[model samples]
Each structure stands twice: as structure tokens, then as C-alpha cells.
Target: MNKSSGPDKNRMDVKKLVSIGIAFTLFFIAQGNILTVTDGGYSPSPKLCSTLKLVPILSLLCVVILVFVLIKMLKHKYVHFKNRELDSKTGSNGLSSMQKDNERKRPAGAKNKTIGMGTDVIKLFQQMKDDISEENTLTLGYRHLLDLACEHLDFSAGVIFIIDHNGCISLRGYSGIIPNSQENYTLELKGIVSELFERNMPRFIRDINSIPGNCQELFYGFKAAWLLPLMPQGFPVGLLIFFHKDVPKHREEYYPKLDFVNIAACWFYENHRNNRIVACENRKIEMLIKTSLAISSSLSLDDVCRILVSDIGKSFGCSYSYLLLSRGRQKEMYVQQCYSERKTPVFEPEEKIIDIENMTWLKEIIAFETPVLLGSEEIKGYPQKDKDILKISGSAGVLIAPLKHNKRLVGILVLVEQRSAERARMGKEVLDLCTALIAQASAAIENARLYSSLSDKVAQLTTMVNVGKALNSDLTLLSFFERVLDGISRNFKIQNCAILLRDFEKDELYVVSVIGHYQEDALNKRFKIGKEGITGRAAALKKTINVDDVSKDDMFIPSTGNTGSEMAIPVILNGEVVGVLDVESEDKYAFSKREEILLSSLMNQVAVAMEKIKLKQLDKERANKLSLTNTLVKKLSGTLDQSDLLANAV
Candidate 1:
């Protein structure tokens, strides 16, 4: 051991010697001091007894000193442990009473607005963790954080100014400014906030004069101002500005609490931002999965289209949606599938035909054919009448993503809705959904093409059967036409029905039948095949027209019982249109898929009946001639009169 350690050793030696001396003296006393005497049996003298008592008292005093030393060692151990945790936990190893008292008494703001700054400081950090857990988006994280600060702190007003990639400070949200007024201050708040953020540090100013003139003069005038870096390294992500009457001026006594709060602030932004990013990634994965499922699970084109549009809209929170497709060889765009939200939905007809240019958004969407997005300004371009309709239908903005697939533009989709900032963020998911719908639409078109070809073969077979029946049965032309017309019209759900057949000898088409809610013009009107009127026109062109709105259709002639919609299908025999089956409806686009097939069926029957009737007339003529010739032969054999035989033939 070193010489310096000797004093401590000597002190230990003295204590050991004192203990031995005290023990020896006690033993000597107990053995009895050499005295005897009176009433008690052989007791030591008072002097010896007093010496023993003194030893025990001194020993007890020494024990007390050892205990004091042990206590000191234990206290030193406790202090060491507390120092580490306090520094890491609070960033401040020691805090003065006044600082702690002030923190407890006041959080962030005035009495009425108790920011519960302490509570909020903790909550904000907690919120950062939750946001990171969701992994939705940094923007969302910023919103929640700003809200928590403004709400918990009793500041008169507050704002979160964010530093963008361009190193510019931009005001994101404000609790005090009217929502409408937010735009005015966005650019104005940029300069100073940006400079402060560039400094990459925290600053608290009680009055404007405390700050350097140019940098914080404007900020200082705001009563109390606090700026905290969103990130630790000084590249600012965001900053909070508080205007509060309750906050005491920042001073040395209050620095520790400030230190803790600032540390928490930076952590809040970083963690929350990271969480949002993760959430965004997860959402993208989910959408990809859903898109794949929709394409595989649905079979029919219409079903797939409906599913694609609706799921995307709901998943993305869009209020209204529908699909538009090109129809016929002319590529006329019309509404194919339509749906809307339960709370708010689009109300346009399922079959809207667009022609010319700029008639409405429907036409504009077709023109662009790309994803055309529209907000209030774009939607306002609609006609005053349409605008009124749009308002009632809860549409102020819209986005139309064309169902473009396979390099062959298939269709367009219209999504109309109203939304808030938060709600709009939710809508990004819907945008992706539009891409999935494009594939489903192409499959649908192919399916439709197959169904059309199959329906044609059925029509041909049906025509042959109907012709045989008409020739075999001797029903009057009017009665036969009525049964055929009614069957076709009723099946197609046509509100009005009329048939015009060609007159071979007259070289004209005349009304062969009419069955409807409205009366016909004397029921005997006739016209050349290529003349005016829908029936005549159909015969002229040998085509079909399924017009949704008769009033809007130039081909339609005015009639009674509100003829809002109409269709004309030509009946052909021997590669020529012999007649036309005309139908009308009080409702626009009344012909669904099932209804259209019914019209074709009725037209098939008419074509067959016409062919059968013509054949029967020839057969009857042949039979009559045969009978005349037989009778003449019998007469001639008996009378030998050639002139009589000829007369008999007639």
C-alpha cells in the first residue's frame, strides 16, 4: 500500500486496539475486583464497574460513526444512478426550483388556454409514434402535430410553417385566420420564417425589441414568439409559431424546460414524417392487391366495369362515378355503366350520348380522352342549366379518367365529388383505381361483340320458324301483324309500336301494323321506302336506330303520348328491307339489353311471315291451274271442244 493509505490504516488500527482494551477490562471486572462485603455476595468495587460501563458506551459511539460512513457511501451510489437517467431523459441534469415551479404552473399559454404545454409536449411525442405506426403520410403527420400544438397550447393563434425543398418557408395551417383568408398570407409569411429556419436553431422572444432588427422584428411584434427546428441537424422541415399572452418571457431559469420541449418538438416531426411515409407505402401495396383481385374475379364486362369504378371510388372516397363507351361503327360515346355514393352520387342518365363539341363535360372528357381533372373553375364551365343540376346532384368538381386500354381507346369514366383537403388526400387511391378499370373494360367489349354475333344467328332461325307459322295459319294480315307487333313491342318494353311494310305493286311502304299508347295517322299512311318518317328511313337504309330521346332526334316525327325515346329496326327478306318495326317510349333510353333482343325477335318473325305469305300465293295459283287442266281434259274428251277447254282453264 502507498504511504498516503497509511493514515486510513492507522485509524483502523486504533479502533481495533480500543475494542481489545474495552473487552479485556470488562473481563477483569466480571472476574470480581478483590473486595468483599456486607449484604451482597462478592461484588466488584464501584470503580471497576464504572470502567466497564464506560467501555460499552465508547464502543456504541464507534458503531454510530461506522454507520454514518456506510450511509454516505450508499447516498453517493444513489446520486450517480440518478445523474445519468436525468441527463438522458430531460437533456438537463439539474433543474432549478423556479424552473420546475414555472413549468408546473404554466404549460404554454394563458390561464384560459392552458396549453398543458407539459402534457402536450408529451402527447405530441406520443402522437408522433402513433402516426409512424399508421405510416400514412408526412403531410398527415404535420397536420395532426400542428393541430395538437394549437389546441393544447393556450396561444391566441398558431401556425406551422414548413420548409420546402426550395428552402422556402410556407405556412401550412392556421388556427386563427379565417379559412378563406389563408391564401393571402401564404406568400407574405415566407421571408422571415425562411431565414429563421435557415439558422437551424430554437428562438424565443418575449418582445420584438429583443431580436435583431431585420430578422425577428416582425416576429417579435407578435407578443410572444417561439420557433423550434423540425429537424435536429438544422435543415428545417417545419416550425411552430405561437402568439400567447400567458407565456412568461424566456430566461435562464426557464431554459431547462425549453430545452426539453424543443428536443421533443424535433423528435415529433421526424418520427411522424417517417411514419406517414411507411403508411403510404403500405396503402400502395393494398391497392395493387385489390386491382389484381378485381381483374381476376369479375367475368362480364359490365360487372367488371361497375366493380372497378365503385370499388375505386369507395376506396378513394369519391362521391360519384360512371363509365362511358363508344357504341356502333360511328364511335358514338354514350354512358355505359353508372353509380353514385350513398351520401352523395352522380345522377346523369346511364346512356348519355355525346356529339359535336363542348356540349358538356361529357364531351370534353371524350375530347381529351386522357385523364381530365376538373375543380370548381373547370366545373363552372358547364352550362347554367347543367350547373344548377350539378349543384342539386352535389357536384362542384370532377375528375374524368379515360378507360384507355390496349392502345384501342375503349371508354371514359366521370368521377364527380366535393371534398376537403384531408378528404382529397384520401382520393389519391381512387386515381389508381381508374387504371385498373381500363383492362376490365376491354374484356367487356370483346364479350359484347360475341353476344351480338350469337343474337344474329338466333334471329335467322327464328325468322324461318315464324314464316312457316304465318303461311300455315290463315290469320288476317292485320290480326297477324298485331300479334307480331305486340309481341315485339311489349317484349322490348316499347311504349308505342308501328309497322310499315313495302307494297310490291305500288312500289311504296305502307303501315302494315301499329300498336301503341298513341293513335296512328288514319292507320293507312304510305310512303316511298326512302321517304320521310322513321319507318321509311329504316327501310331506306336497311339499318337500326336506337335513339334514347325522340324529341332530340331529327329522324323522329312528332307524335302523341310523350314520345321521348324511340327505336326502329328493319325487317329484311331476301337481302332487302321489306318493312320496319318502329317503337317509342315515354322514358329516354328505355331499351335495356333484354329489351333490344326482344325487338330483334319480333322483327325476325315479321320477316319470316312475309316470306311465307308470298310463297303460299304461288302454291295456290299452281294448284288451281292443275285442277282447271284436269277438268278441261275430261270435258274435252267427251265434247271435243278446244275453246271450251280454254274457257274452263280461265
Candidate 2:
């Protein structure tokens, strides 16, 4: 029943054995030694021999020989079956039928070489499919694969370069003796190399010197090489190069034999690549969640700026991150926050003030309120200042995201990619990935700004109420003016403040009271209305005026050299200019529209209070005169002397 037993031999052997069994049965019958069947039961023959002497000696000898012959034949058949079964089970050590036929004809040691090569290939694939642990990174796995490949193909050395999804080619692994002169590691798909990848086949270089100069260095110590493009799904993901010190005798034979190895390498690399992509995506999701939490945790502008720069720089793996904000209606931007991944940062936080006029690219982004990507080509068209800033970071690409809400540009976020071919290729992809994050950040930043502005408005209203109380309080003219100046300085945090009243009869403006660092000449300083200082101009025009930079204003008459900015508001009474309220600061553009409104309202109350105090002084003066006149008339009437009365009148 063994599968390996030959059918013809088994049939012939079975017939011979059957014929022998019949002969033996006939002999037993003739001697009456066999049992006979009866109606009721089997009975032994009455004439059965009791001793061997009764039988013929020749027959006994024949019987013995037949038994021995049967035993020998059976043993021989058993041996044949076992040998055939072994042959079928092991498949003659994986040799094909043709190989087995010609194997005997082949010369000595050829079979052994073939067998060894097969064993090595099997071992290589087994090791390639082995589980990768945490300690065995993808790069290490590639190196191990390269080593196994070199051993299997009988190559001296090998290296692997992988082309990632970003279209960047990078060296992943190397094995065996790398030459000392091979310092350049950068590899690219160029000319024949590119064509090799496109063909998706293995190439053999008979002479290393025959290849391009850029690739010849890779085979410095080698005479020839095998270039295999590891393609998993009909597209090359990696390139494997095997170096040989001597040119292969059968160069064409070697390339065809790489089919199995190429398949295994491609599968291994593609699987690892997919895993890495999934892990990266998961990381991005985690970063997005964390950044969202950080952004929502604060309503302060400063805090938001800090979180934005820090989180974005870390999340995107950028060289630098910057937050720039537009102040008021100016066409300028100031760096609110900066984060750098480099050990030595190039720019400090709030250290840069950018003029939008000079940077047309930034100006376009602000105007359009859209994100922009600046690659080398785009950067070339930009201004020198912009180029210099980018150069400082060693960046080859830039992403500028506008932070806006309701069509208003509140600020912009800048992300810089360092000078790496891989990073430069990733710019567009990174921009796409960060689009959602930028949108979320924009909304959050806008909300934070609004909250901050609301808080400022509330504080301004509180200051206005307190200042109005001081202005309306019952006090003498000098005391009233002093209290007004004191309230203005304390509530508004102004370093300098003064009330300059117009002397209409003299067509001049004179300082009534001053607060904080005013020069002695400024205490009672007078100006010709309509032709003099900022305060006088405001009084003449009966309007509010703000000089962001006092030094730049032609009509600015400095109370102190330290004042960088000034604001003047005219206090009006009964449609007439009563006085001007002037505020100064050492910082330019220190005042906003809210501050102007608050001060203007307080000035109105000051005008009303001044009028009330002036009325009270006039009534007291008239009463004193009336009382003195009455006392004089009473003395004259009682004395009845015309001369005394005339003298009193005089």
C-alpha cells in the first residue's frame, strides 16, 4: 500500500506468492493433514502423521527452502518500500526530476554548490519574515537583511537606499567593508538610476567605472555591482545595491536569480513603511488634541501667543515658529512670540518689528487672509529683509498662516522648515496637514483677542467713572485742576498730564496744572492759539488730536525730551473751547481709541465743573462788595457829616 511501491513488480510478486501458497495447500491435502468440513462440526483426519519420519526427507527439505525463500522475498520487498517512501517524503532534497536525471551527469561538487545556495536563500527569507521587536528598528532590520542578502548572493558588501513617500531618497542601511573615501552619503535617482527604478528590474554593472560619476564612488573598492529596485506593488520603494570585488562570471545569471530576494525585500520594506505612516498619523492626532487643549485653556493674548508658538513648533517639527500681530490700523507687525528648535535661537521673542510695506509677500497674505507657502522660487521674489530672516533660520521653505476672523487679519503664524531636501519636499504636505490646526488656532486667537479687548474696555469704563467723580467734586479752582490732573495720571497710568486753558482775551493758551516730570518752564508755559503746540492746536480746532511719535510732529513743543507720544483733547463749554487736556508717554503709539474716548468724556465733566466753580467765586465777590458798601452808607447816615460821607465815598 506504500505510494512508492512499483505496481508491476508488486503484481508479479503477488502472483508468485499466490502460486506458492496453492502448492503448499495441495501438499497438505495429499498428506491428509488439512481439516475437513462436516455437517455438525470439523473433525481431524484419522490418518494424520505423528512424526517427521513418516514424511519424505526430500519434501521436508523443499518445505524448509520454500519458507526461507518466502521470508527473504518479503524482507526484500519491505526494504524497497521504505527506500521509496523516504525518497517521496524528502523529494530527493528538493531536486527537480530533470535535475536529478542530469545530476549524475554533472561534474563533481556542482550539486553541492546548488544545494548550498538553495539552503541560504531559504534561510534568508525565513529571517526576513521574522518578528521585529522594539529593539530592532526598521533601519536595523534593513541592515540585517542586507547582510543576509550579501551572503546569499556571494557578494562582498551591500547598501540600501529607501525612497520615502515624500519623494526623498535616503540611505537606510549598509553592510560589509565600506571604503574610507565614501564620505558622501547623499543619493538621488538620476539618469540610469532613475530608469532602473522605472523598469522595476535588477541591473548588473560589469564594471563600476562604467556607471555615472556620482554612483561610481559607491563602489570604490568593488569592480562590479548588482542594483535591485525593491518593488512591492509594481513601484520601487527602495534600491538595494550588492557590491562584488570581481565581476561575476555569469553576470546575466545573477540578475535573474534575484527575483525571490527582491520580492522579500520589497515586502519587508513596504510593511514597515506602512506601519511608520500609521504611527505618524496617530502622533499627529495626539498633537492636535493637545494643542487644541492648550489653546482653549487661556483667554489672555500673551498666553495664547506663547502656547501657539511653542505647540506649533513642537508639533510640526519646524526649525522656528513665530506669532506676529498687527497693532491697531498700522501696516506693521510685531513679533508677539517666538519658539526655536535649534540649540541657539536666532531671534528673541518680541525682538522684531516687521514693516508690511517692504514685505510684499507678507502684505499679500495679510490682505488676502489666506495661508501661503514660500519655497525657493517664491522666496526669491521677496524682499531682502524677508530673505535675510529666512536665511537666519537656515530654512529652505516657509509656511505663513493668517490668523483672522470675520475677514479681519488679527495676526499671522510662521512655520519654517530647515535646509533639508527631505524637509523641503515635505513643505506642501506639511502645509496640508497643518491646515486644520491653523484654522482652529485662528479662531482661538481671535477669541482671545476679543476677550482681552473686552477686559480693557471694562477697565477703561471703570477709570472713566472714577475720574468723573474727581472732576465733579466740590473744590476750589486750583484744587479742582490739581485733582483732575491727579485722577488722569493715576487712572490712565500716564506719566505726564496737564490742563492747558485758553486765554481768549490774550489769544493764547496757558498751562493750568501739570503732573509728572514737567519742566519749570512748562508749568506756566503759554502758546499762541492755532499757531503753537499740540495742545494749542487742539484748542484752536476744538477737536481731539493724537501724535503717536511726538518727535515726528512739526508742531510738537516738548515738555520733556523723554516723551515719545502725546494725545490732546479740547474741553468744551457752551459750544466754546474752555481748555485742552494733554497726555504724554515715553512709548510710541501708547494710546488707543478707547483711551481717547474716556479722556474726552472726562474733559467734558472738567469743563462743567470749572464753570460751576467760576460762578460760585463771582457770587462771593459780589456779596463782599455789597456788605462793604452797606457798612459805609450806615456810618455816613449815623454821623450826619457831609465831609465824612464824601471822604468815605472818595
Candidate 3:
């Protein structure tokens, strides 16, 4: 029936052919009685017997040929069947092997696809790495990152936000059509961003309507958004947001691709952070250099203060800045200089003396020798005086940095932040910078003060030396006094000056020499020591007395015209006050410590010169008396009259 059964039918046909040949030989032998040949050895059956033998031989010949043909046909059929069976088995095995091969190749194809994706990611990373290396500024780096992200990730628009020290995010860089009102958008999304940042995960919003109604407008034209938190050191330092106007094809691919983008964003954040640190350090160095130059360029305290305040204000972008310097032995603080952005009048009254000890915050700052930052809200709770001061400054935030030199508080630097939100976020970095700047400025200020003091002292000594030279020359007592008075009036710029000599026997002070508008009235004036005016007081006490306002001073007896200020220095020789040097002025607070010291020095020279003049007068008078005695004795000896000699001696 089938090809596989064809070999069996062929074998049956061969057997039938053998059987028919044998039957033909048997019939012919029976008909001709060829088997009777055994008995016909004696009797011959002539033509029939011969014909039967011939028939038997012919049948045998036919049977042999048929058998040969059958054998050949059977062999050929067997070979064909064996070949067909082998082919059939081979075909079946081939089918199964092909299926197994396909199964084996499927995973290889997937592996190749995965490898290709990985290769692309690696290439992108390399590209970004190059960008990081080439970019010199943080802005440029951020821009490059945004551009790369949009190009590779199929983002229509993107924005990058950096977190400030106060944990507020502000837009730093962007690409594509970011609206100008993005600040409002950012504010609205701050809550969502905070949650996502806290979770440290990326979020994909597929539907714009899913967002809050108020925030939905931010993504009006965008069909989707990918919010990727840029976490460095497991803390959110920034965020990278990508938006799409329409859903991207092969959207499933974006999920895996986002991993690469996340890695890239982290790199970008790290790079930007490093750049900011370097830039900040550079800025600090530059500011220090400029400040040093500005401070050193001038020797005047006013100039130094102005430069310091201006430089600090510009550096920090502050609205107001001022410097408070400590003065007097009591260490009272005073506002030395002030600067403000607004032209409005000051809100608080000016204070001539600041009681720093009464202000707890200022005392703390000085005691700790550290800076203090105050907010407007906290300032409201402070003392009334301090509260008024801050309110007058119009500051939302304030920084007070103490200026110290050699462990002593020299001054305080006050910076006021009015409108800048950026300045309000000053952290440790800003504090450190301010500390360094203040340290340098303090040193400069201290040096300037020391130099000015030394210069004044030198000038005073020079003046004293010149006065000594003039007084030591050959001059009479009256001439010497007049020269000293002239020198004092010229050098000190005092219009009213007088020298009062102590009359020890009378226990009183009398004006020996006077040079002023009331010279005639004051020259012979007399007053009791230890009981009268400033001059008497100085002689009795053997010290200097300075009066800022002679009219207000109880010890002042204003006799030398309407004197407003006065200074009296006692002239001492051999530990005893011999006289008093008195100088007066028509202006209040006219005498400084330096002037007082200089006057005392000049008075010492005058006292020494006066003592020398007195000794010279005594020598001249003795010589005249000795010469008179010798002349009288010579005249008496020549006359030889005892009575006359006695009269001359008497």
C-alpha cells in the first residue's frame, strides 16, 4: 500500500514466478510419461518420451532464468527500500536537530542585544567623562549635562536644580523651552521633590493630570516627566528633571536607560560640587589679597575703616555694614563707621558710649572670640536697645564677627543682609571666610594705631630737644622765660599760656610769665597752693590736671579770659614741684594725652634752665662784693690811717 510495504510485495512476486515454472515442468513430464523411463529401459515409447524429456529441460531452463531475474529484482528492491528508510530517519532527525539549534541560538541573540545596550551606555559615560574634564566652569558643566541628557534620553526639555546650604533648591541650568515662570513651578513641586529625595528614588509620571491642579500647569505641554534625584554620598545634592512633550516609542527601554542617566547625573553633581569648592576657595583668596592691599595702602584709621567696610560689603553682597571700635580705659564701644544701601535716615539714635557688658549677646561674642549670626525673628526677642539697632539696619539677617588682636577685642564687624536670600544661606564656609578677613583687618588696624602713636611720641621728643637747645644758650632769666613761653605757644597752638612759679615761703603760686590776651592781668596774679585754681592744684599735687571744659570743672577758676578747656602740668626739680605750666583753649576737649605729655617734658627742661640761671646770678653778685672789699682795703693801706681803715671796714 505504501512505499515502505513495496519491498514485501516484490518478494511475493518472485516466489510466484518460481512456483509457475515448477508447475509447467511437472505437467509436461506427466503427459509424456517421462517418469516411465525407468521401466522403458526395455520398451521404448518413441516421440512422446523424447518430447517430455525436452519439455523437462525447457521448464528447467525457464525456471533458472526466472529465479535469476527474481533474485536481481529482489536485491534491487531491497537496496531501494533500505535507502528510502535511511533517508526517512535522517529527515526526522534533521527536523528535531533544527528545532534544538533554534532553541540554542535564541539566548545568544538576546545576549547580543543586551551587550549592545551596555555598549551604548558605556559610550555615553565616556562622552560625559570627557565633557567633565573639558569644562572649566560649573555652569558649562551643568549645561553640557542637560544637553547630553536631552539628546540621548529623548527629553524635550530639562532643568537642573542645585541645593543650597539651607536645603533650598534653585535652578542652576536648563535646556530647551523652560518657561520664565519656572520659579513658581519649582515652588509648587518642592513638596514632591522633597518626598522623592527623602526616598532616594526616581519617579516617572505618565499622566500630567495625576499631578495637583495647581502644579499641573507646570507640565501643561508635557505628557510625561522623569524626576531623577542626584544623590551623592547618599544625600540629595541636586535634582535632574526631564520632560517629554509626547510619549516616546519603546517606552519600556527608557526604564533601563535611566540607570545610565542616573550614574551620569551623579558624576555631574560631584564634578559641580568640586568646582564650587575650588571657586569658593579662589574667591576667598582673591578677597584676602584685595583686602590686604586696601588696608595697607593707607595709614589713617578712617581710611582703613572705610576700606574694610566697603570691601566686606561688596564681598558678601550685604545691604549694610558698620565697624564698632572699643575706646577709653573702660573699653566702651563706639560706631566708628557705617554704610547702608538705602538713603533713609537711621532709625535708632546714635550712641556715644556702648555698654558692651550690659549686652549679653555682644559679651558672649567677645568672650568666645567667635562670630554670631542672628535672624530678624531672633533679634525681636533681644534687649530693646539691640532690637532697635537691628531694626534700624533694616536687616533680615545679621552677622557679627569680632575683631581681636593679641587676645584683646579690638572691634566688631557687623554685616546686614536685607534682600539677598543667597547671603542668608551663609554656612560654615562663609563664616570661615569672614573670620579670616576679620583677622587680617584687625592686625592691620592694630599696626596702624601703633604706628600713629609712635610717630606722635617721636615728634614730641623732637620738640622737647629743640626747646632745650634754645633755652641752654646764653640768655638772661627774663629772656629765657620769654623764649620758653614763645616756644610753648608756637608749638602747642595754644593762644593762652602762662608759667606759675611756686613761692614756697609764702605757700602760694604766682604767674612768673604770661603770653596771651590777658598777659598784663595774669603776669602778677597770685593764688594759695592746695586751695585755689587748676595751676595751684597742679603745683600742690605735683601732677598734671586736664579739664575738657574749664567752665564745667569745679577746680577751674577761669581768670585768664573765658577759657573752655585747660591743661596744667607741674614742673618738678629734685623731686619738688617748683612751678606749674598752664595752657588754655577756647574749645572743649582741646587737650589730648600726647599734648599733655609733651607739655610736661618741656616744663622739665624749663625748670632745669631756671635753676642754672639762679646759680649764675648768685656768682655775679658775690664777685661784685669781693671786688668792692679789695678796693677799699687797698685805699686804706696806702693812707696808713688806722681810724680811716676801721671806718672803711665798718
List model 1 lDDT by residue over 387-431, tens digit each: 553331334357677655455556666676765432443333344
lDDT tens digits, residue span 23-134, model 3 = 9768756665434455446333465555666777788887887787778667666655654574353222111221222223322233223224644665675576567557
| Model 1: worst 10 consecutive residues (lDDT sum) | 107-116
Residue 549 CA displacement from its true place in model 3, Å = 4.9
For model 1, name the residue pairs that clash.
115-152, 115-153, 132-275, 135-275, 135-279, 136-279, 137-276, 467-608
List the RMSD of every prediction in angstroms.
Answer: 14.2, 13.8, 23.5
Report residue 97 deviation for candidate 1 (angstroms): 29
For model 1, give the RMSD to the true fold: 14.2
| Model 3: per-residue Cα lDDT at residue 50 | 57
In candidate 2, list every pair of residues with a backbone clash.
none
TM for candidate 2 is: 0.57
